[model samples]
Target: MLFPYLLKVSLLLGVLTLGYRWMVQFETYSKFNRLLLWLNVLAAWSLPLIPLPNWGPTRIQAEFHQSIPKIAQAAPAVKHKIAAYNPAPTVVSHQRLSSLNQKLKSLHVMQWLLVVYISGVLVLASHFFYQVGGLVWVLLRSPKEKSDRRVVFVRNLRSNSPYSFFQWIIVNPEKHQPGELQHIIAHETEHALQWHSLDLLLAELQRIVLWFNPFAWFHQKLVQANLEYLADRAVLDGGFERKQYQYSLLNAILCTTEVPLTTSFAQSLLKNRIKMMNKKPSHYLAWGKYALLLAVLYVSSAFVAPYTLTLVKLPPSILRPALKTLATNDKVNFKEVSSKILSLGPSKAESLIEELKKKTPETTKAIQPSRSKWVIKKNDALFWVISPLATLDDINEIRNEVKSFDAELNINSIEYDPLQSFIARITVHVNVKSGSSSTAKEGTDRYSPMKGESGYLTKSGSLGTGSVPNELEKQLQMDYEKALALSKKNEPYYFETRLMEKITALGSSSSHAFDKNTLNGAAAESAFRYDGVGKSTDNFLKLEPEHRNSELYLNSKPATFTELNSLSFDLVRSIKIIRDARGKKYMIVYTN
Candidate 1:
C-alpha cells in the first residue's frame, strides 16, 4: 500500500515541480500562480502524512523516501546529457538498444504492483467523497414551497433543511424585516441560477480524494470565497447603494443563521470580500501561463529519477513445494542436497534428483536403488535406470549406496491393513530397461533355456553349449555380464527375505489366495534385482512359499514364461531377428 501511494504522490509531485519551474522561467508568474505553486507543494508533501487504505501513514512516508530520493542530483546530470547529445551515425543501433534497456528497467513488477495499490486507494477516496457529500445534502434540506424563481431566506438562526441542491427560500420568520427577505431571496436565487450546487459537489469530491493535499483544500476554500464575492457584487449591480448594501451584508451576517445549503453569508469574512469588490479586476494571461505550466510539468515529470526494483523468479516445479515448506515451517532449507550435488559436479541428472528430494522427501526415500540409478515418476510413467557397477560392494547393497535417490520416485498408492499390521499391496509402476531396447530382450532371453517361455518361469533352459553358435554365445555372455553387473550394484537382495516373511504370514491365514493372475502380475513387475553371482536380473518371481509339496522356498519366473523349452527357444531366436528394429522386448530369466 505504501509503495503504491508513494508512486502516485511522486508522479504528481514530479509533474507539478517541473510545471512550477517552467512557469517561473517563462516570466508568467503572478500571485495566483504563486498561490497554486504553494498549494501543490503542500499537497504533495502532505500525501505521505495521509493514511493509505492498506498501509499506515508512517509506512507510506517511509516508502515515499525510499522510492524517490529527496535531493535529485541525478536529474541535473541527466538533463545535461540530454542537452549535450551528439548523434553518432555509426551507433544508432546502440542508442536504440540503450533506450529499450531503459524502458524495460522502468516497467518493473513492483511498479505494476504500486499501480494496482493506488488504483484501489483512488476508488476508496471516491466513495468517501460521495458519502460525505450525501450527508451534507441530507442536512441542508428546507421545507419550502416549490417555485420557478430561486429564493434565499436570511434568518437569525440556521434551519435543518435537506434541500442543498435546489433553490429554496427559508427565513427566520421571527427576525425577518420587511425588505430583508427580498434581499436574501435575490442572493439565494442568483446561486441557483448559476448552478452553484454542481460546482460545490465537484469541489467537495476533489477535496476528499486529495484530502492530504493542503493546497487542494485551500483551492476549494478559494473557489467558495470567490463565488460568495461574486454573489455580493451582483446585489450591488442591482441598483443598491454601496453603503446600504454593505450595511445589509453586515446586518444579514448578524441576523441570518447559517443554513446547510446556503454558503455562509456572514460578516466573518465580509471585510475581505468588500475590499476585493472595491478593487479593480486584475487580468490573467491564462493561455501563456497555462501552456508554460503544462510544458514544465511534462518535462519535469519525464526527467525525475526512475526507480529500479529487482525480482527473482523460481521455476514452477520448485515454487509450490518451496512455498508450502516455507509457510509451514517458517524456513525452507535444501542446502544439504544442493551442496552435495554441487560438490559432485553439476549434472542434469543430479540436479533433478536433488530438486525432487527438496519437494517430496517421503517419495524420494522409497526410490533409492544406487548412486547411479534415478527413479523418476512423472504422470503415469515410472522409470528407473540401473547403471553399471563401479565397485564389488555395490552388488546386493541397497542401503545408502546412491545418495538416496528415492526423492525422484513417485509413490502412486499405498494400501495398508492395520488389522493384520501388513501392507496388502504396494502398486508401484516402474520402467526397467537394461542397456537399450535392442540389448534388453537379448539379455533377458539369455536365461530362457532354463524354464522355456511359460510367462511364469525365471530362467531359460540351456541349449547344449556345443550346439549353440559361437558368435551368438559370445554376444549373449557379454550382454549377460553387463546386465548382471548393473543388478549387482542396485539390487536389494535382503528385500526378498522381508517379502517372503510377509508372504508366509498372508498364506498361513488362508484368507490370502495364491491365484495365477496375482502371481503372473507380480512376476511381470520389474524391480532392481540381483543374482547370487554379482549380476543384475530382470526376471520376476512366482513364489509358492507354502507350496504344500514343493521343496524349493520360491519359484522364479521370466517375463515370458509360458512356452516349452523348444518353442521358447524358437521364439527367442525369432525375437533376435528384428530386435533392433522396433517394439518392446522382454527378458526371460530363470534361476534355480
Candidate 2:
C-alpha cells in the first residue's frame, strides 16, 4: 500500500517537473512559471494525503462456496470410487509456535526505513525553524532607514550579505559602492515587492517534509533560479547597465549568505542568470504553454482518485429450509440440498425455506427400523409407503407433487395389498398441506423383506443384518467424543482468547481474532475476515496500510502474504500474533 502511494507521488512529481521543463525550454514568462511550480509542488505533496473513497478500489470481500461434499453411489456390477472430502487440520508443535511468535516481534527492513526517514524530517524541520528565527533576529538588530517613500532599507547589519525577508530589504551600505548598492537595492526590492520570501519559505517546508527526495531538492533549485531571473530582469528593465549589473552579481557571490526563509540578491549559478538576461524574449504563442499545467493536474487527480464497491454476503439462516427438505426425504443428501439453497441466494432461499417449513405440521423424524435390512437396496431403488389407501391415479398425482419439490425422488412401482381391499403397497409422498391429507406415522417399517431358505438370499447363504455388541458400541461413542474435543482444540478460534480480550478492552468491534500461535497465514486471515462471527476483518487491511503486516509459511517455508484472496486457506495451520506499535487499531497475521 505504501509503495503504491509513493509511486503515485513520484508520478505527480515527474509530470509537474516535465511541465516546468517545457516552460523553461521555451523561455515562458517567469511569473507564470512561478505560479505553475508552486501549484504543482503543493499538489504533488497533498494529492496522496487526501483521503479518497476507500470502499471503491481497495475493498476486498471473502467469497462464499458451497461446503457440502458430493457423493455418487454406483450399482453392484460396476466399480465405485468413494472420496470423502474433509477440511484437513494443520498441526504445529508447541515449541515451533513459540519460536514463530518470537520471530514475528523482530523489526523488519521497512520499519527501519521509516525510522530513518522520520529522523531526517525532524532534523530538517528543526533547522528550517531555526533559520526563520535567525532572520527575525537580524531584523531586530539592523538599523532601519527609509530609502524612498516606496522602499524601506535596513543598513549596517553585521552580516555584509544583502537579502530580502518579507517586505524588508536588508543590505550593508559599507560593503558596496553607491552605484553597486543601487543595483543591489533594486534586486532585493524586486524580491520584497514580489513576495519571493514566501516562495522560499514554502520551498523550505517542502524540503523538510521530502528531505529524502532528490526531486524535491531539484524543484527548490528551480524555484530559486526563477526568482533570481525575475529579479535580474527587473534591474535590467529599470535601465541598469547589463555589464555593471553582471559585475556586481559576480563580485557578491563570495560574500552571499542567506537563510532558508530569505531571498538573497547574489548567489551561485550566475551562468544561468546571465544566460537568461541575454536570451531573446519569448513569443506570445509560448504563453500558451501554461495550459500543460492544467493537463498535468488532471492526470494526477485521475491517478489518485479512488473507486467503490458494495460487499455482499448471504446469511446462514437460509440453509435451514434446505436442511428441512433433506430431512423429509428418505435419502438425506446434503450436496443436493446445499446446491438448491445456494442457487436461490440467501434471501430467496431463506424465504422459500420458511414457506416450506410452514407447510409441514411438525419436524420429520429419522427412520429407526425394528430390524435392520437383510439385503440393503440402493437409495434410488428404495421407496417409502406414505399412504396405503390412495388409488393409482392418486399415487401418480402425489409422485408428481413430490418430484416437483425435489426431482431426485424416483417412484417406479405401485401395487394393491392382497389381503386388505382398497389398501395400496405403492409409495407416494407429498407435502401434508397439499390437499391430499393421508398421514403416515413416523419411524414406520417401510423396508421389510421376508427371510426364506430360497428367496432373495445373498451368496453367503443367509441374509445377514450386522450388529455391533453393546460394549463395543459404547467404546466407539467414547472415541468419537474424544476425537471431537481434540479437533475443536486445534481450530483457529481455540487460541484467540487473549487477542479477543485485548480487542474488547479497546472498545472497538472491528478488531479481528486469529489464533496466531496455532493457525497458519491463510487460515488465520480467513478466520479474521469470515469466521461467521459478529464482525468481519475484510476491510481491516485497507484501514491502515503501513501497519498491515502478515508473515506466511507454506510447509514451513517462508511465503509472501500480500492479499487474503490469493491465499489457499486449507494449507494454513499456525500463525504468530503481532500488534501494531502505532496507537490505531491494526492487526498482523502470521501463518504456517
Would you list the C-alpha lDDT of every candidate in the order shown?
A: 0.38, 0.52
lDDT of 1 by residue, 115-153 (tens): 765676588577765665854454366344555555443
lDDT leader: 2
* Span of 10 residues, lowest total lDDT, candidate 1: 451-460
Error of 1 at 110 (Å): 13
lDDT of 1 at 156: 24
- Stretches of candidate 2 exceeding 4 Å from the true structure: 1-7, 49-105, 108-110, 147-151, 308-592
TM-score against native, each model: 0.31, 0.43
What does candidate 2 score on TM?
A: 0.43
lDDT of 2 by residue, 1-592 (tens): 4655666666777778777876653383787778878888778867765533322222111011111111122324577797987888877779988798777678697887788878998999888778778877877887888765366787755766788887888888889888888888889888888889888878777777667777778778888888888889988999999999999988888788765667887768789889998888888777566666675566555455321111112212222344655554867555455455434533354355445534533322422221222211221111222233334564455344334324222333444322222332332222221111111121112121111110111111111011222222344345334434443343333234434556557564444344433233445455444432111243222212332344332322444434433444443333334333333433333344
Number of the predicted model whose TM-score against the real structure is largest: 2
Model 2 residue 93 lDDT? 79
